[model samples]
Structures are given as C-alpha cells and as structure tokens.
Target: MISTRKKLLAASIAALLSQAGMNSLQAQEVIDEMVVTTVRMSEPLLVETDPRKPRQPLPAHDGADFLKTIPGFSVIRKGGADGDPVFRGMAGSRLSLQVDGESVLGGCGHRMDPPTAYIFPEAFESIQVIKGPQSVQHGPGNAAGVVKFERNRTRVTEPTVAIHTSALGASFGRHDEVLDASYKTPEFTVRAIGTNAAQNNYKDGDGTEVHSNYQRWSTQLSAAWTPTDTQFYEITAGRSDGEAAYADRGMDGSLFEREHYGFKGSIDNVSTLVSNIEFQYYYQYIDHVMDNYSLRTRPAGVTERAMNPDRETRGGKFAVTLQPFAGLTWVMGMDAQGNKHSDRSSMNMAMTDYRNLLRKRDAEFSQTGAFTEVSWDYNTTQTLSAGVRADRWSAKDHRSMVMLTHMMTLPNPTTGMKRDDTLTSAFVRLESQLGDMPGTVYVGVGHNERFPDYWELISKESAATTSAFNSTDPEKLTQLDAGYIYNRGNLRGSFSVFYNEIKDYILIDSAFRKPAAMMGMTRVATIARNVDARSWGAEADFTYGFADNWRAELTLASVRGENKTDNRTLAQLPPLEARLGVHYDNQTWSFGTLLRAIGSQDRVDIGRGNIAGQDFSATNSANVLSINAGWKPAARWMVTAGVDNALDKTYAEHISRAGTDVAGYTQIARVNEPGRTLWMKAQFTF
Candidate 1:
C-alpha cells in the first residue's frame, strides 16, 4: 500500500541523493564560503547544460508539462489542466512569467491558472529562460519571452532537513502526487511544498470519451535570516486550490484560487576589494472562480444551470544593483500592478434558488513601471548589455450587463475591440567572446508598447469596447534577436534567431454571431478586430557527455506566424518540434529516455475564415516516448520508476480543444497523448 504519499516520496529521494553527496562534500569543506561579488555578467549561468549533469524530469501532464523539453517550446492542450506556452510564435500576454521577479498572470480568460501554476520543480533551485526582447530587467509585458523560477539559499554548516516524493500513473485514469520540504539552520531557513493531480475520461485515437477531468493543490512557506556571511533575509507564503472539467469550454474551473506573499533582503562586501550594492522587494496575490457546475450538459438533465466568476490580483517589483568599477555594471528597476473582476449567475435546480436567476458584476486594472540597465567588460574577451523601459497603464468598467458587453457596442471579430492607450518601451544589446572562436556571439533590438486586457477590453462587441481595446491606442512591437554559443569539454551548444513586427495586431473570430436566450435566459456575445502581423523563429540546444555516467541531449524548435492581412497561418503557431535525451547516473542509479517529434501543419487563414477555414492541414504527425528510473539505498533514501507512451502513439496538439460530436470526431482529431503510462517514486532526508 505504500501510501502516505509514497512514504513521503521515498524519504525525499533519499534526501536529494544525500544532498547530492553533500554538494560534493562542501567542495572540500565549507571553510569561508563567503563569495559575493556582484553585477553585470549576462548569459553565463546555465546551472546544467551538462557538467556533472544528470538532468531528466519530463513526462509531464500539466503546466505545459515539462515545458515541452524546452527549445522554442510549445503546448496548448485543453484536456489536462490548462496547457498554454507557445514561445517563438508567441502566446498570451506575449509570454512573461516570473516567481522571483513577480508577475504570474493567468486565471483562465480561458486559461485556468497557467503561469506554470506558480511552479514547484521540487521547490526550485533554478529555471531561467529569456528569449526575445533581450531582457529589460524582468517585468512590464516582456515582448514574447521570459520565464524565471528561482529559489536559492541553502548551505548548511550545522542544522539540516529535506524531503521529496512522487507517484504517477497514466492513460485515461491518470494520477499524480508530490511533496517537498527543506530546512537548514545556522540562523534560520525553511521551505515546504505539496502537489496533487488526477485525470479520467479519456479516449482518442479513433475512440472518443474526452471530457478531461482535473484536481489540484499547492502550499508553500519559506523563511530565511542569515545574520552573517555578509547579510541576508527572506520570507515567502503561498496557497493554491483547484478543480477542472471541460470538453472545450462551456464553463468549468470551479475555483482555482491562489494567494501568495513575499519579501526579500540581501547585502554584500566582506573585505571590500571593490565597490558593491544591491536591494530588492516583491509581493503577489491572485484569486479566481468559474462555473457551470464544474463541466456542463444542461438541456434536460439540468443541474440548475450555474455561472459565477471572480478575480482579484495584485503585484510588485523593485530592484537596484551597482558595482561602479572593475569593468563596470549597473541595474535599476520599479514595477506595480492591481486588478479586480467579479460576476455571478444562477437559476436554481442545484444551487438552491436565490432570486430565480441572478447576475453580479465588477472590474478594474492598473500598471506602473520604470527601468534601466548597463553592463560592460573589455577584458576577459568583450561583453556588453543595454536596456530601457517605461510604463503607465489604467482601466475601469464599473459594470453595466457590462452593456451587451463587447467593449460596450458594435462589431464582432471574436471579442477584442479597442480604445485604452498608454505605454512605452526600448532595448539594446551586444555580446562577444573569441579566443579563436569556440563560442559566444549575440545581438538584440527591441521596441514594445502594449496596454489592453480584461479580454482585450470588456470581451468586445465594439464602441471599440468603450474606447478601450487600444484604450484609444496602444499596441506596437518590433523585435530582432540573434544568437550563437558553443563550448567543448563535454560539449554544449546553442543557436537562436527571431523576428517580429506587429502594429495594432489584434484579431479573434471564434465563429461570429449568436443571440438566443429565454429558457432560463443567458446570452452574452463578442467579436473583435484590428490587424497586421508577422513572426519568425528558430532554436536549438545541445549537450553531450559520453562516459562517467553517459549523457546526451538535443532539442530543436521552429515557429511561423503570419497574417499580414491575408497572408495565412497564425492560429496558434507552434508546429515543427523535436526533443531527444539519453541519460544515466552512477553511485546508486538513475536512467532516462525522452523523445518527442512533431510535424504537420495544414495551413489556413483563407482571408480570415468564412466556410473557407477549418482545414488545419488535416493535422497529423506526432511521436512521444518516455522511460525513467532512479534509486538510492543508503545515505537517506530514494526510489523512482518509469514507462510513458512507450508505444501508444496517436498525436494531437494545436493548442488543444476539439471533439464536437461526429462520434466526437476522435476527440478533436485525436489529440490525446497519454497511452502506456506508469510511474513510481520516493524520497527523504534529514
């Protein structure tokens, strides 16, 4: 029965592989360990692209599941806890998610708590990704890129404790569970995390059952205070809840509330050999709710039709850094946010009558910002970094049916009319390293200005959504990025390319026209507009280490999005994909297998639809496979198992959501990718 969360996840992977062998025995005993010399050193912190590496933990089912094993990254599935992350071709809010840098927007605007569900990569140690817009100090609508999840600070010289666990089973009725804990004291330190997941109702590959089930959980706590070694302080708090059901939306998200708290502190300089300075502050909160009795069927077997929506958001950011000399460095920042939304509906039958059928409402939003950056190094082989940012945003709707909502009157392209405006942005970059070419070369250019949310402005219907989609005007983008990196000595590589040009680009047309309500009345329509677009992409990541525990990895990505008026494509761009892996570890055991290949797009954009759309190029071509293993006996405890897909392939991924009868059309042309699954895990350390 090994329950109790698999005996506390095998005592937390036998105490993180005995703390990864006590971090290789404190790199020869932690004597002084007070190394803090700040600032300016862009790109060069890839904890593990390979180097005593052992990476492997992707066979995901949620949170865009293991980020599609990185590359350009892609995911838009609907039947497994909200999936959405299409970088390269871009996705929602131009992709920007941070944990240590605030901003984590996602509460189902048909999204359901995305933003990697507030992360839990075993209580993070690091996971940073920055693609386009080249970094403006993390925050303020990051033009199609940026991902950060960092939780560092743990170096026990005295007290210590740790734990982790896992259990998984897949195929239709899937299940998952995880738990994490940490504690280290010389002064103080603590951490805790928990997670749970479930799945059922699955059938694709010609057989349909699709209805996607779900359940979720999260909890976190952190505290740190180091009286010396320079100085330090930290505080964190968290809470999360979940529920899901949808066969392509009609309503269901039941209640996915999340509330988080934060605080941080730092200081450095022990024997000043040069100048230094640093400071930071952060905060967050989010709450959401949705309904239709969780899923929906209402026609005769009514469950008293229901609908209730709610949202509340708050954000923060602050930063400063300086090194003043020795090759120079500097950084400065500021950020702010606020939001609110509310809605209600009911017709008694299961929610117990309350004034027959009621509808409630609320809305508001705000943003503020300031930024700066600089970095230089002429010796150690040339280095440079540059940046800029400026922002001020606002919004309000005060409620009215929100008024046949649709931005308060006229036109429907799908829901996104414009009017609201106020934004500013800028960027720059350059990098080089040539001791006779072995790696490193880069360039960047950026310009962005955006302001429009709350469904691009009251779910649109036009007065341009009350003079607010563009809030009167605010939407622009111009970008270019280039890259190359290499290393030998066990091999490591990178390649990147990107291009974007968008001006007033806003389009949504999910089948226009609809107005019928009386059998318990409820009709709210939408249509949106604005156009001009272009997108381009390329990505590659590599790693190799053949021996002393074998290893190999390769990832490739491609993207294309267009709509230069009547150019085509662009309906969730994210096709061409690839992933490969082979790993093995010693001194106990660890094994792996990961391979994913996807290709096949049918091309569309017949002048933006009208019986000429819906070809998706007959979508086809998908391969996925996985296998894993881990075990550690003494030194604390650990265990892990595997088997995923392993020969049960039938693909579907186009941002997910399909299956509207015709025998459910193979659940949306068969896009269920979970068939031969199984899993096991355990861990603990103290």
Candidate 2:
C-alpha cells in the first residue's frame, strides 16, 4: 500500500519544481552534467556510470539496481531493496565488490542483505564494472570480475566550500533526498554526506499488489590532511539503517543497520624505486533483523518469526607502485581480512527482544593475500601486462546443528570444525594498436581460485557419514577475456567475449525435499556438491552520434553455462537480452527513450542454483518501453523525469524464485516486476 505521507511529500516536490517554471527560463546551464544515456569505454570492458547524470525511467535505488544499466549485469530482485547483483552467470561472492576501496560483506545467510544493499548509489561518486576475470588487483576469486563504487576527493586549489543536493518523488509513494557538503583548504578538509529514500509496495502489469517496500537512510563524515602536494591522509566514518519488505521470501527485513570506519594514507614520489605508496585499513559491522510482523501481516498458521544476525569484518591493504625503468611499471600489494558471523533468535517466534537473548557465533572466516602486477611498454604500438596473486583462506563452524529428525536428538553431523585452503590466481594479456584502423585489440587469459563462502560451509544440513562442508573444495576458474575498442568519426563501439573452464565447480542441488513427517517441518534445503562446468558468453556496448542533435546507444548480452558432471545446463542462467536507446540534447534541455527486450530461457536445470535464487517456469520473455526528459535552465539546479515500463507489461526475471505460494496456481511464486509508474526529481550543485 502506498503511504499517504510519502504521497504528500511527492506532491510537494512536484509543486516545487512546477513553480520554478524551468521550461521558459533563458538562463544558460553551466553546471557539470552527468550522463544517463551512455558511458565511454574507459578501458577495455570497464564501464563507469556517471552518478550525477543518471538515465531516466526506473532510477537505481541501490548499488545493484544501478549496475543493471550496464551490459552483462543483472539483479535478482526479491523486493524493492537489497537486490543481489549477477554478472554473466556468476552471483554472490564470485563477483568482487568494493565501496570506496573497502570490501564489505552481508550477514544474511538467505541473502536478504547483500553487499550492494548497504550502498546508496546517489551518495557515491561513480560506479565501475570490469567484466570477466582479466585482472587480480581488486581481490581473489573474482571469477566474474569486479564492481567498485568510488568516491574520490579532489585536491583543493584554494579555500572552498562546496555543496550538492538532490530530491526525488515518484508514484507508489516514492521519495528520496540527498545532500553532500565539503569544506576544504590547502592544508585540511572535512566532508559530510547523507541520503534518505523510501518507497511503498508496487503493482504489476495486471494491477496486482506486490510486497516490495522499503525505507533507508545513511550518513558519513570524513576528515583529511594534506601538508604536501604528494602526501595525504584521510579518515572516514559512516553509519546506515533501513527496513524492507520482500514478496519472494516469507519474511521481511525490519532492521538493516551497518557501521564503517576507515583510514587511508598515500605518498607520491617517495623514492626513485617507489613511485607511489598507499595504505588502507577498514572496519565494517552489519547488524540485521528479519521477521514476519514488522512489514507484513503474519499468516494464521505461520508463527511470528524473527532473527537477529551480526557480522564483523576488519581488513587492510598496502600497495606500492614502482618504476624501476622508464618503460616498465609495477604495482604490488597485500590484503588481509578477518570476519565473524553470529546470530541470536527467539524460539518462541514472537516479537522477541534480541538484546535479551544470548548470541551464538555460527562461523568465523579469515583470508590473507598478496598480488603483483607488471606492465611493460615496448613501444607506442604494443604493450604487455601480467599479474599473479595468492590467497590463504580458512573457516570454522561453531553452530550446534544437533539433528532432531522425527523428535530424536542425534549426534551433530557437521563435525563443527575448521577448514583451510590455499588458492592462487594469475593472468597475462597482450595489447597492440590496429594500425590505421582506429581501434585497439587485446586478448588475455586468467586463472582464479575462490574459496567457498559461508552459505556453502555452515548453512548445510550435515550428513551422518560425511561432512558436506569438508567435501567442498576451492573453485578453480580459468578464463579468457578479449575485446577491441573502435573509435572512428562519430561512431564508437566495443565488443568483448569470454570463455571459462571451471574445475571443482560448486553447484547447489536443492532437489532434496524433506517431508514434515521426517523433519517436523517441510523445507527445501540446498545441498552443495562439486561439478565440472564450462561457460562462454559475450556482450557489447556501443554508441553512435548521428543527426544534428541525436545519438543512439545499444547494448547486447548473452551467456551459456553447462555442468559436465550432470550433463545438464547451468542453473539460474539468463537468456539473451538487448537494450536500445535514443537521445536528443539541446543547450539547456535533453530527452531520451529506451527499449528493453528479454529473451526466454529454455536451457535451465530446475531446483539448482547458488544462493541468489532458483529458476522457475513462471519466467516469460517480455518487451518494455520507457521515455524521459530533463530541464537544466540554471547552473545551480536541474530537473529530470521519466516513466519506466510505460506499457505496464508483466514479466519475471529468470533468476527470480516463485512468489508467495497460492493454492492451485502453478506460477504462484513468480514475483512480477513493477507496473507502469511515474516519478520526477530535481538536482542541485553549488
């Protein structure tokens, strides 16, 4: 249900903008413009989203939502908030994620709070995506590449005070506000930022209500000192809290609180051997609460259930850039992390107080890694690069999962012990300019090793004769990343393809169905097992400037994964998809529209997938259209508005699970996308 208060707020925002009358203003807009239409290919297969210039229609609510605009990226939406990002066919920890160069992890075992869930995209500077396992600089086990939300601090030229603020309102009682302010001088600086966003449940194309609703807020403070041109030290502290409702799951997130603290220092031209050196240390904490009563009504037969989970992570990194020769560059770094996951719950299944309950640590994980990358410039036409990294990981299970099958207490099957692994990754690539062709072609291959995360380790029902946690081994990923960038005249295009061969690929087989008679409650539990898998995929993003005031942007993505052990296709693999856009821009205004089409996925292994979600037959191919316009009559303020899914078509993503179950309905669990909605926003920079 749409909240009345939010509706009033939306009305106020609309009136405020309408009263401005920007359409007739003749003032020239001189503010820095952010582009929602397209992003230039910064590097081969690396895409950067301009946070200020967001695209129209369905604006991103979180980090994962924002990533969907890029090719080869998708989100498994369980609700309006905290969606998990999927790249190609990889999800979860397979994709390395960093915010402000800090690594953070979620505490929910069911993935109600993913890493991206903690990020408010509008408050960040930029988002970058590196497709495929082409490099090891970010982190280890990045078989699906890396995504980074960066906030860069610029050196103060003089004493300055800057502020940026924006507000948004939309249908379904959606409201968002953001503010960032910084004061700087040559010697020191301080910055403060905050964001608030909320939305109510939405209806599908059929006008059926969905359970997705959320309200979230975040704030951060930073202080830095710069005594010299080549040296600087900064400290950042932040805290965030939120609540969300999910239609796909039985429970909702009532409390999503997180805290972060980080310290960073950098020095340039330290010595001839060391060109640059930087160090970072960060501490992150996640305290999450999931229940059935806060955001949704409890069903008659269902007991009011609630869970409180916590995760603490501390990590640090030290890197050095070296220039031993004029044409050679080397970057070497080491990173380490220590993590602890625990939870407290009330067995009474009421609105129980978490503070009154005793906390139990379920698992502990730790990692240490070292990496070195080198690039050699033989000439202006050719260059060679290579990198290698190694990591040591360990995990310990402390949960007491004593078997109580059929009302009998049996010995714990999980063995509740520790496991350790040593993994290594490396890559090499060659690049050369295509002479006279106005394009660059590059090819590279890499090997990545990823240790099993918490889901695979402590979330399983142990066996009597064997331990599922111990049987699982580190996943070995060997892949090739290659593409070319072509820029000639007004047309610019880039295409990339990747192939991967995985050994000891961990596949989750959730085909096991335990009857209530045997387990006292019916449950569909996932079982982790090893499999041999091979995958290949390709995606391309292109832009062409044509006509007097027009430009076109196109994107295409596809992937195929197969399990050799079971001789079946990989589960949760999305089908081919395409997005095309056209835009018209004038000196003070701009407008655009986009067409999105999703292909039906026929190659799927039912009842198998990672922690993201399993594929269901309810998925259907669909086509959607949306359009938006913008007005920027003054440099201090600008306004943008758009409608997404104007056709109000009903469709479900292939990676989504079945919605709330309904008797006698086959697709009862298929969570449908939101229906036709309207929204508008105004941004300010001064």
Candidate 3:
C-alpha cells in the first residue's frame, strides 16, 4: 500500500501539471526591460527589482551580496562569499526569506551557510522586498520583513527557444560563468540553469591577504505543462555545492551540498465566488562539512577536527482568492513546514572517521499556519488593507546527552521533551494619494509573536541550565511603520521609518562564563536569554534627472537599538551609511560613479549579539569611491566594467565578526573589506 506522504506527493505533481497552461498564458504578456543601475520603491513599503539585471559595485556573487545593495540592509562577512544577511538590525529567523515559494535553511551550527548561501542571484527573474511586518501572507515569525525570489513561467504559442549567458572576470583570480536556456511551446516548456563562481584569497586595504577563498557551482532544471488557457502546472529540481574559507573561525567550510524539489499549480476562474486557486509543495536537504585542515594548514600541535551536519525540510502551501464584492478582494491560505537536523563528527582527519559514523539526530521542528488578507478600494484615492495569521509551532529535543567538553558529558535535561506554542500575528495599513499631487502616503501597525528557533533552543545553553531549549521564551513585537513615495516629472524619491517595542526578546551573550573549578580554571560559554528591547530607524532615497541623459541619486539609512533590560545599547547594529551616485546614460552607452560614506559607531555592548556573531568594538568611519561604464556593442550583446574600492580604503563593517588566528593568514582585529579591485562582465541574449 502507498503511504500517505507518497500519495500526497503524487497528487501535488498531477495538480501542478494541470495548471501550467494558465501561468504560460500570463508569461506571454510580459515585456523584457532594460538593465537596472539603481532600485527604487515600487509601492509603499515594497521594493521590487530584476535580479538578472546588472548593477553597480560589481555583479553580486550571492544573495547576501545582492541584498546589501538595498537600503537598510547589511552583511555579516564570514569570508569572501557566503555571508549572512541582516535587515533593520535583525538577523536569523526574524526575517523571512523565500525562494520560488520555498524556505531553505542552512545546516551549519555557526551559520557558515545561511539560506542565501545556496542562492544564485542571476538564476531568478525578480526579487521582491516587503519591509516591516505589514503583511502576513508569506509565512510565520517574520517580525522584520519578507524577501522573495521568484521565477516567472513562460508559455509560447509557437515553438521558441531562448538563451541568456554571461561571464565575469575580476581582480584576485576571480571568475564566474552563468547560463540560462529554455524551450517553450503551446503544450509544454522546459528550462535549464547553471552557474559557476570561484575566487582566490583577497587582500585588505593594507595589502594583507585574508583567508577568504571559495568555489561554488549550481544547476537546476524545470518543466511545465499547460493543458488549457486557465490551467498550469510545473515541477522543478536543483542542486548546489561549494567550499569556503573563513577568517573569523578556526574551521573552514569544506562542503556545502544542497538538493531541492518543488511542484506547483494554479487554476483561474475556479468559481463565481472564488476567482483563483494556487498550490505548491517543496522539499529541501542540506549536507554540510567543515574542517580545520581542508582549506587552511592545520596549526602545529593541534589535533585535526571535522564536523558534518545535515538538515531536511518539507513544506507546502495552498491559497484561494475571492472577489466577494465590488472593489474588495480577499485571499485565504494555509501553509505547513517540518524539518529535522542531525550531526556527526570526528577528532582525527586522516581516517575520515566521521564518514563511517552514524549521524545523531539532534532536533526536530514543525509549524502549521493559516492566514487571511483583505484589500478594499475605499475610493479612487484611498485604499485599506489588513491581514491576520496564526501558527502552531512544535519542537522536540532529540539529544540523549550534552557534551560540555570532549572529556565532560552530562545527561540532557530536556531529552525527549516536546514544546508547543500557538503564535498570532496581524497587520493593518491605509494608503492615500496626496491631493492634486503625484505622491502617495501610507501608515501601518503590526503585531507578531515569534517562537524560539533551533539555534536559540538547541545550539546554545541557558544562563544556568544545560540547554536553552525550555528556558528561552517566545518574542512578542509591536511595530509602527509609515512611509511616503513621491514622483513628479523627472524627480522621484521615497522615505520610510519604523519603531519597534519587543517583549521577551531572545538575546545571545557570548561572554557567559562557568564557575571556576578546583584549579581555578574558568570556561566561557555562549548562552541565550530573554530581554526587553526597542529599536527605531529610517531609510530615504532620492533621484533627480538633470541635463539630458544625466541623473543624480542619493540614499541614506540608519538604525538604533536599546536593550531595556540591561540598559545598554543593543549589540550588532549597523551604523549610519549613505550613498551618492551620478550617471549619464544614452541608448548605446552609460557611465556612472558612486561615493559611499559610513559614519563611525561608538555605541557598543561587546560580547553580546545574535547567533551568527557578536560586537567586538566600535567601528570608525570610512569613505570609498567607485566608477563603472557600460557599452552595448549590438542589440543582443553588452559589456560592463568597474573598479570597486578605488581608493584602497582599509575598513570593516560594524556588524562583521572578529578575526581569528589561522595558519597561512594574517590575523586582524576584524575581517576587513576587500581592497581596490577591478572587474568586467559580458552578457549575451539570444
């Protein structure tokens, strides 16, 4: 007899194929747009841009790099690539990141591979950023915001083939190759994508080489079947692998392997009351390995050590849209996700002992959620929108014992213990057009209750307990968001602000110490604790077209946080930053320059931060200049070249992790940014 999981999987695939036709018809109406040099607000609290388009400061190498180009975003650099993304002073699970309607998680205990690590920017069609907790449509626990990377399905009335390819070469032995090809017909469509990127160790402004080198590759295949104009179905599969050397940790990532599968479908005109229905299911698996001897030389007198961790995730979503009344629309949906994590390790490298050992299950998690959102056009110039969501979250501790050290072990206090919580989140917003002006304004308020994540529960210990699994409390947040967008003639700009008050906020303290033993020996331990916190910030951007084919743009962002429980500044917050750009563009050629300035940050709460890293010290101000140019030699071919960090300014971001000593690498106070670098890219479409 077929199992229930197998039956569900088969049904999902069949349904996806039946709905492929509707998505293909919609794709036929899209028009290819030009390259985007700068992204701007598309709607209140929303920003959208094409990920395939080339941008300044060199093309992105990963998802985190691309996000850093947006305002109110930062990266916690671990190496030359695979950095973790931070938005609005929040990291980890606070921000919801989805790719093609699927949530992919990392398998590293130290966050060497964030969700963005497996993402290749150029492989996606569009990237959408919904700032603040202004909507509850995606998933649960998105207290900060939501980011979605989507791919559009294409359908053709006649047999057609499309191909897009690009090559990039830059300083420090860096090179990349990307290819996207597709074949489409009235009956079916198939697409394939592949990417390869690698780089040698890069030097800081002082010409000192850092232990940051990496190589990565990925491939994906997708197919869609369209039976009719109102039905569409699709399936996708992909895999990726990579290795990265980090300067902030004792070990380097030797392997990052990922496998993913997805099925989706949509049906239009389902009924008179229900206008549309959509459903999707996805499965993802990650196998990660890290060691001290793979990328860097093992330190003398130190035993070679390696660790392998893996995670499996499965999830699905279903939704329906209804036109209940004139000028009013409603969308209702439900989603469910489950994940499991396991680990294996070895103290010796020569024997490859870890490969022969069985993986020990450490944690399991699951969540089921339902949501409804509504939009109403109150008048021609005014609109109202609201959404509410509830999620049932469950977690289980699978560890039988905890290891205080290689020689010390203790019985797990929460072994086989399961915890469950029902969390609620909601948001409401109102938007209105300025009278007699080409401008729009909006205001919103949101409340979110977020359950503790794996890192907070199983990875760290409590202040006095063996594990934080049962000690840390869920976080409750209330935030106010407001923004304005203005567009008139050749001038356009946007400004947004947010304020947040949090109760029982989860905080990580990396300096916690165990009591001294008989020999008066103290050991440091990282712990998780709950605290009250508040934060506020603002982001603004403006652009003006001056002389013909000339434009000037300015963008600014800053955020501040306070730990009310401790009466100190919140740790790991990014400092004030601004960017100014001048550009001249004609149909055939373009030239641009960017000036980036970051202000000094003095507020600090050292040894405390998020799961990824902690604040070491205050950071100093820095400024850098860069220039780029692009030329279209033919209708289907384009070339772009640029110089980043033109002034060779040696600097590191305030949120970066502190550097650790490593063999064959110079140790620094913090992982520094790349020095002066040159890069070039060529793209072709056929």
lDDT of each: 0.59, 0.80, 0.87
Tens digits of per-residue lDDT, candidate 2, 507-551, equal 877775645445577655466777999999988877655554566
What is candidate 3's CA lDDT for residue 102?
A: 93
TM-score of model 2 (CA atoms): 0.91
The regions of model 2 sitting more than 4 angstroms off are: 1-40, 349-352, 402-411, 462-467, 513-524, 661-668
Encode model 3's per-residue lDDT on 1-686: one tens digit a residue. 57988978867844543343223222111112233445677689998888776766664478888887788988999889988889998998888899998988899987899989989988998889899888888998888899899988756789899899999999988998999999988879899999999999999899989899999999999999987777889999999999999999999999999999999999888888888899999999999999988899998987788989999999999999998877788999999999999998887766667989999999999999999999898899988999999999999999998766545667888899999999999999999996644578899999988999888999888999779999999999999999988765456678999999999989999999876444777778889999999999999887766555667778999999999999999899999999998877664788788888998998889999998888889999999888888888898998888888899999999998889999877798999999998988899988
Candidate 1 wrong stretches, greater than 4 Å? 1-63, 66-80, 83-140, 147-170, 173-289, 292-305, 308-344, 347-392, 400-423, 441-485, 493-542, 547-676, 679-686
Q: For model 3, name the residue pairs that clash.
A: 16-233, 19-231, 19-232, 19-233, 20-232, 20-233, 21-226, 21-231, 21-232, 22-231
lDDT of 1 by residue, 535-562 (tens): 8887776655555555566777788877
- What are the clash counts of all predictions, listed in order? 46, 5, 10
| lDDT over C-alpha atoms for residue 203 of model 3 | 93
Those runs of model 3 whose alpha carbons end farther than 4 Å from true positions after fitting are 1-37, 405-408, 516-521
**In terms of TM-score, how similar is model 1 to the real structure?**
0.31
- Estimated TM-score for each candidate: 0.31, 0.91, 0.94
Q: Pick the candidate with the highest lDDT.
A: 3
